[model samples]
Target: MTRTPQCPGCGREDRLQAVPAVYLGGRDTVRVRVRNPDDHHDRTVDRPVTTALSEALAPVPEPPSRAIGCLGVLALLVAVGTFAAGAGAGHWLDDVPVVEGGGVFDENGIFHAPGQELPTAGPAWPDFAWLAVISALALTAAVLVLVLRIRSRRAFTRLTSGRAQAERLWSRAWYCHRCGTVHFRDAPGEDTRPLTFQEFRERVWQEGGYGDLAATQRALGGVLSIRPGQ
Candidate 1:
């Protein structure tokens, strides 16, 4: 039979508990009085343990959402509509005759010769075509942004999965209540020095493939950084 590892601080193996079990056993319930005088019943609130031990053993936070929102889709749609409208307008305007000089039509529909006044309107096809090009560019940009956001979201999901696996590895750790430290049975080396809660958690993250994710997050400006309790 394999012998359990001894605690580094106390040189004993008796007062040990699994990290998950410790967290579960640390929970407490409290009664909260209602504010309204008419409501005499007190409400019971179940609160998780917030002690240093519990904090060290807490599960990894959920990944941040990076998917494009509804507003973004709406803007993309608007750009497409604008592009279509501009293209159609430009096509129709291309066939229209340009007004070169001021003229008037007689009551019998006969064209009158140019007067002293000059034509105020210029050809509109160029402006409409320019509008179409601008809207097309905007639509392209919106699509690129949406794709990037989706990729970012997928990366975050992978990171979250890695953290969860790390948490599972952490569950195998044993906390020594007597020495206020934690140790892993299968950890390498026989030095047996007790690790603080922070040290243990950090070790778990680093060794469980979570370090790579964290480095990537830092490189990407921390967009995948863990959020507060939510």
Candidate 2:
């Protein structure tokens, strides 16, 4: 069974109901559904986002991948550069043995003194090689953080209409909530995609639900007027 978890954003006992799953594409938010207790009205409506604090708690969508790709490239370049610095320090700065093994004590090879090991150890590499590695990695981290911040900012604007969609939704849901009056103009959108009552609650509530859950309870109260507690 699709049991609902209380919304972490709102701290309500309501859960995700099937039939009409919430649609979350317009503003790049991970939107979800909320509903009245045990009420199953098969109508969908958009809700304004009321609780700024609660809305802040909702999941933000991922930033565009191009920004992420650039960050990865920066990280890879840093890794390669650091590795090269270490390799160069070890190979060029340090002295390797001239002879493969103790062949002969001659000009072509270095003669080891009595009771000595082959390929004698040399001076340790400079500490500056390690500093190069650290510096490169730090630059990569800074670049990635900047890109993420920019992308997230752009995504935030998409949730609210650019004044156009709002005009449309307002034109559509143009009925008095206090009374059971209907709108003069027909809701423009087609019933193209039929949603369950639970899904309907989630989609419309994305905008308006957080302001006052009590207001929602009141709006729904009319539908559920028969029940004593409703």
Model 2 over residues 27-67: C-alpha lDDT tens digits?
A: 23334466555685444446543232122122222224566
lDDT of 1 by residue, 91-155 (tens): 63444444346777655666756643333356555767767776777777688878777777787
Global lDDT of each model?
0.61, 0.40
Model 1 ranges with Cα > 4 A deviation? 1-4, 28-31, 36-49, 59-157, 188-192, 211-230
Residue 169 displacement (Å), model 2: 7.5
Give per-model TM-scores: 0.43, 0.27
